[model samples]
Target: MNGKQKQSYKYDKHKQRLFIIPARITSNVNNDILVIDRIYDDDDGRVVVLDREGQVKWTYQGNPQVNSGDKLFNPTDIVITSVGHVIVSDVNNHALHVLSGEGDVLTCKVMEDQGIIFPMSLDIDTKGQLWVGCHSGDDQRKDAKLHVIKMSF
Candidate 1:
């Protein structure tokens, strides 16, 4: 293969087949691959965690209680913290969903109070803080902003 050519496939070892539609991906310190699978024509999106050997560890499809009205609609980005927590930016939901290493929903923070409209991307800094990039809710697109949130866990 040429240097510019790359190959990609979606296979789940446990299922013995290809099943993942990866939209965004990130890795933890332990090299665990965290993938966000965007499901078309459905309200349910998924977060799949896989080991280095392509073995499925755990999967999250959003918490119904926390995501009651909105759901995990259109997860744009994902970031894993040093401590193993998975944070996802839910653009349509206008919130950040925090999940445990085991795929349980720990907390969901609606950024409305913080002036965050459509959170599109996020990253964890060396100091373990979360920097979120958001677009304005206003149709004029004159109020985009970036928010820095101090993470405790």
Candidate 2:
């Protein structure tokens, strides 16, 4: 096993498994902490919020505020908009989920269509345009690509 070492880790003795532990991101909103639950269910992943000292603040399940065609699947990356909206990158679904700062689904936008496979990361530029990175699902050899979406005021 030749790779970089992890910061912290945990072991499940009963289950006979070892896991790399993750540190928490300090929320700029209120100094609370945030963590991502990488895998859940038979579909995808989700995000969980915690206090500064590691306490639950909030969490978003697969269900967005509005249920429609194709929900979030395996959310892998997240970002906060200038207007205080939660932008979650749903890898399996090849799209983005826009939510209120409090974790309420405001809207869902299909970031790509043609060959967009799995988006892994997201960010909002100073101009408010959305940027995305595509992983293996895209199969482009680049491992990732950049895209800009027109921002809606």
Candidate 3:
């Protein structure tokens, strides 16, 4: 093999052959693997956190408190904050989800009023600022803009 041979393994502890579509991935300061499970079926999108040993630590489907009327349709990207919180860009929901290190839903906000068309990606800088890139919801693609928000933690 040109690259290092990588072994394949399943994440689901119950189902031996359950398939997982990992769209985006990142590692926390603790070396935990955070993955965005993008299954295109009856099931909604979810975020799976795994330990260094490939063991499933916790899974976050969506934040009910923020998404009271909808499910986590499509999570495009994820970034772990300095405090170990996982921030996800909920594309279809038009929202940003903040999850605690242990997979608890800390907060969720739909930023439609803030001119967020379709947030597709995000990252945190050394100064603790969040930069969000969005796809234009308008047909002409003229509404696309980058959003910068100062993050405390």
> What is the per-residue lDDT of model 1 for residues 20-98, given as tens digits with 9 covering 90 to 100?
3677888887888888887774445778888877788888766565577645556778998888889988777788889
lDDT of 2 at 46: 60
Residue by residue across 61-134, what tens digits does model 2's lDDT show? 55543223555456677777677777777777677777777777788766556565677777778888888877
Predicted model with the maximum TM-score = 3
Whichever of 1 and 2 has more lDDT, that candidate is: 1
Clashes per prediction?
A: 0, 2, 0
Best by lDDT: 3
Q: How many backbone clashes does candidate 3 have?
A: 0
How much lDDT does each candidate structure score?
A: 0.78, 0.61, 0.80
Find the 10 residues in a row with the least total lDDT in model 2: 17-26
Ranking by lDDT: 3, 1, 2
- The stretch of ten residues in a row with the least summed lDDT in candidate 3 is 11-20
Better TM-score candidate (2, 3): 3
Q: TM-score-based ranking, best first?
A: 3, 1, 2
